[model samples]
Target: MSAATATKTAIPPSGGGLSRESHPLAGTGTLLRFNLRRDRVRLPVWIGALFLGTLSTLSSTVSQYPEAEDRRSAAGSLDSPAGLAMTGPGHYLDDYNYGSMLSHQMLGFMAVLVGLMSVLIVARHTRTEEETGRAELVRATVVGRHAHLTAALVTAALANLALGLLIAVGVGGQGTEGVNWGGSLLYGAVHTMAGLVFAAVAAITVQISQYARGASGMALAVIGVAYALRAAGDVGNGVLSWLSPIGWAQRTYPYVDDRWWPVLLGLALAAVATVVAYRLSTLRDVGGSLRATRLGSPVASAALTRPIGFALRLHRGMLAGFGAGLLLMGVMYGSILGDAEEMIEDVDELREAVEKIGGATIAESFASTVMIVIAVVAAVYVVMATLRPQSEETAGRAEPLLATGLSRTCWVASHLAVAMGGGVAILFLTGLGFGISGAVATGDGGLFLDLLIAPLAYAPALWVTAGITVTLFGWLPRITAVAWIVPVYAFLVGYLGQILDFPDWLNNLSPFGHVAKLPAEAMEWTPALILTALAAALVALGLAGFRRRDLETK
Candidate 1:
């Protein structure tokens, strides 16, 4: 039979009901291999970054504080509100060892990122395929129900294990005396287990939702809850923190107590979760969700008719939530700014670090700068939200809409407008909140102007991220993740390099680095305008490319 005919004949039901005689492994092994091949480049990038992060931490720690007293001062800085809120509770930083210092300052973020990578990989491989109907086609051809699911977990597990081992080598290579190789191993173990725990959670979410977006949301919610519970536990009562996966990993106390038991506990929970996920997968139909989305209004709302209106409809909720979050962050960071000045007065090294980021400045200015950094992060969400239209089009959802009466430009522009415009508004509000509160605390109304200006300084970088997404969405649609991933890499370079004492070239990649450090440094319009123009040009190029390309096939 011809390949086209064979492909057509091979598919059983579009909805993916399988026959009893179908072999689970029939098409699965090959698909797994194909997936591995596809992920070869992406996997290496992620794993390499994770290991590099660990190595950077070790090297930077040893270099930054060669003296014992310096290490103590640095450790003491952790008790301050700015440190604890930005990093985490610093209970473990008393030790001068490279491992303990890094574990206290950096490991939580590592664990969070590793888990994030694992969850994204698994969600994309499994739930996404089902959502797109590809899984149904594969499942109809003697592929076992468990094959795709199994492959996702296996792939995530393998990637995470490799990441852990690389981290182990990275930490050991630091050449620190009295280095606890065993403790380092346990450190890697704890992070790897955290990845596994989230991987299992993602698997379970995929089975429950059978859709990528929903699964991603579920996984992120888990991360958010874990962070919140852990933060509360770390700050207030220890009881709530134990409820969070992040707390469990942190409580492992990698360098101080050097406990391996918490990691095993993570493993135990992961195992149970995996088994349950497998059972659910067996019982559920492909592309079927356990929880149903409530039906929308039978008739379209009046506001849904216009492209901009429709875009606003889709993004309004998230924008509101982000705005609220920024306000909350403003209050948290602003309130802590006063406390930070008091707490860090005795710590020279800590003071130096802060001064480097933002010079000897009023606490309100420092708070405004910090809030702006966070607003930079929120810009990423804005870009992702804006790119949704492009993603939908590339995934074939836009095809039918276009086939009807919808124009491609209008639809795409709508999402972009929401992403760009909404981002600025939210950021402005965040700055307002942060600036106003900090000014009130310092009894200086001038702080409000600084706060407002800080977010404006960051606007160019935010638009650049969004513009890149839009540009990519039009051309090379298949690799559109590049738009988001590149900015993220730039962020890593800037943020982590500052922490790890990386070279100047590394920090310069992000436009954020070039933007005037508001309230901390004098404002410069040259770089800001340049970044804004670049971002606008990128969006124009993307739009031009998108207009020329044929509608993507599902």
Candidate 2:
């Protein structure tokens, strides 16, 4: 052999050999450790929220129903399809106690929270990293092909495990009379399994979509569908419940039957999903997805020539998804209104509680409560939409758009307009859905008009939330993520304040707390007008700040 040829043959290629590449899971531990470090703040926040929320629910249940008679009365009132639909199956209703009551009230919400946590974590590590080109930089090192995916999965699994342990500890600390360690562990385990199942689903979804946004949307869509299915199943027959992870968790009956079988189903499905994700990961190139992206138009339409149109185009899909989910939820709540009214009439205690909460009648109170909850949920979309400008700036897209004669004011306003308009659309659709379903169910066509106007009462409150997000985005761009804490805090105050006996002042910190319970009570104009003025002021302040500050870029 030639000397040059021999020298070249003696040296190994920098990219490594096929044998080395074949072991795609190598270096997963190192990547997992890195991921844990990165997620330290995020994971703890999620776990802490779950822990505190669970503890609050447990303590509230015990305090609210201390006596046996009270417990029995509460359980009897919630035994109907409407109650079961709002809660879960209420498997422990027959032999009810504080622990079971807490479980029925908190399990579904906890499961959903954990599911959301898992989906975001998985998508952040997988598709987001790839989309941002960070994964390529990592892969250029000594990392294995599957190290990124493996690390994401392991991190999510560990997070779920930690959350489960926290929940168990929190439940045990509640020290309810009938609460047992086994039941506490079971409750935590069910939530952990539900989180794992969704994590696996997110893993598989990230593989299917090239873009991080697409992956996130797809995973959240699955969560919405699963929740809707569980709601339908709980309100009707028990068959459809078996198809959802949340349903599976609830069916475990932690404080009652303590069934272990449903957990196996979640585990089995997660395993299959993980295997499928790994297989699919091998089939696609980095930044490529199993689902093909559609080609865009070569020519721009007249609408696309404007900033508002462009903003609307970008936000339309997400707004559509949020609107649809809200509509479905509203319909679900409306469908149960008649049943809720009958149950309230039959149970004097429930009627008293409902009246105390500003319900003129059981139906109106129930509908008003549903509207408030839906409004808060829809406000989440407003926050997200408001933060879109920040996301665009960080992604390096805004700089180019600005270079093309687009002023910062116009650009920011475009996104804000979409956020405000989309928020109103979601609120309206939610009210319309409720109104239509309620009118049909109650045989009162006039119900439609009342319900339609109800959600509008909360619009000013939602605008305040959007304004806060915008203000944060403009002034404190780097820490804009802290804006999410606002909605979470609002949820805690608005939903759990009375149950936790929080002071009125603390509850009033949430804009939703300022909103008058409408349709049940006469609409108060003072708070609404004040909130509107505040929202307007905040938006103006944000615009002024954005105009003065340097544009943030990644």
Candidate 3:
């Protein structure tokens, strides 16, 4: 035989066939490099977002509370159960400085963000590629059995390390007297470890579920439950906190205790989760999951005959999850209104800041500010729902339906209807939760009606965001992922513009910035009506463009 052919046919000394010891992770290095190249844009965006979020909180806290006394007063206000529940633990309250307060405000949120990033990245590389049949092609080459999973984990690890370094540099560079470099390092380390724990969880979940969406759903549910456990523990007894990864991260109290033991717990959990994932991986086939997918109905229902009904069936799970989450957030925010009022009353600087931001009253300002934040979050869902058609088309599912009697407009309109209707339903539910909870806390029956009507003011702004996504999906299907940047920009501008003292025109770029701050100011029909008209125009333009465009598929 030719030398090259003979060499290619050669087997290992121990066996003719490849075994676990010989080839389990044979191509891990190559896969790791490939995975890095694939995620170059994605990793940078995740790291930048986490770093910027941390830095902004630090700068804002320093600027808002320059004096030690102001810091202490603010910390004291947050020591209450309501505040603890809204934020994480109040252990940082004991240290009472800019860094500590900033950590208290940002750590839990940052941890969650990193956790989500890790989970999505890992799942995207593992289950998603496998489901799409890309991993099968790669495995048919010289790749090892564990190479894909190992590469995904390594990539996630490297990304987490980068995030940690960024946090450390950003926190240390603040140069405030309150900045403790050791504590800053600890803060970054805890978040990094939190990411690792969730990455492992996602790996294990992907092994358990056949579909990428199911795996991601399971991981996100774990995160949601972890947050809930931590909140309960912080507001009540501290025992429950030990059960949650987030609670473990928060208990580190970076600037206060600077404890490193909880980090060990995170590391141990990650190790255990990784081992479990590997074991499960060995037990399952390449295209199969550890758990069997449940069987669906053999016969289609009458509702499945229509486009809208099929779209609703596809999106019902996502809509339910989003709706429940918004409702829970509304309840939490509403419960804290009384404490917020007390804090504003006790802190003169805070009161001035609120008034400067156009808060007619402290309560009105707090509620309106929260409404704006919720509206921004709702806009994210709007984009996701609107872009569902693009995802469907790229997945090749839309081609089959289009080959039938289904018109392209009908198909696209079905998804848009869900987007618009679902957005309205979620907003209304959030408002209802907030109003009910606020009424219960304050013993004011009138608040139930007032807050209920306030969220509706921002509905037009939400629709505008959806309309933009639809336009992009129609005209720029190849780069429709760029639509995600709109909500991110809107969030930064709407939430942080006034705090960062950005120019009016810069803030005006966000549609939410144009909506009247409800309850704090009178509802202006002119702006709302104008925004609605603009949204309708955008949707019409998008539909026209879509009609003439060729279908783009993967």
TM-scores of the candidates are 0.87, 0.93, 0.93
Q: What is the C-alpha local distance difference test score of candidate 2? A: 0.83
lDDT for each residue of candidate 3 in 260-307, tens digit (9 for 90 to 100): 999999999999999999999999989789998779799989889899
Give the per-residue lDDT of model 2 (tens digit) for 1-554.
67776554445556665545456877788889989998888898888878887786676667667799988887788888878877888567877887788778778877888999999999999998888778888888778989999899999999999989888878866667878888889888988999999999999999999877779899888887787678778878678888888898888888788898999999999999999999999889888899888898999988899999999999998999999988887787778777776665544544654666775556788676556678778888999999989878876788889888899989999999999989999989988988998888777687788888788888898889888888987888877778787677777666555435467898788888888877888889999999999999999888888988997555
Sort order, lDDT high to low: 3, 2, 1
Candidate 3 colliding pairs: none
lDDT of model 3 at residue 173? 73
**What's the alpha carbon RMSD for model 2?**
2.9
Q: How would the candidate models be sorted by TM-score, starting from the highest?
A: 3, 2, 1
* lDDT (0 to 1) per candidate: 0.75, 0.83, 0.84
Which 10 successive residues of model 1 have the least lDDT summed? Answer: 364-373
Worst 10 residues of 2 by lDDT: 344-353
Runs off by more than 4 Å, candidate 2: 1-22, 342-353, 357-360, 499-501
Give the runs in model 1 whose Cα sits over 4 Å from its true position: 1-28, 85-91, 316-328, 342-350, 353-360, 368-372, 436-449, 489-509, 521-530
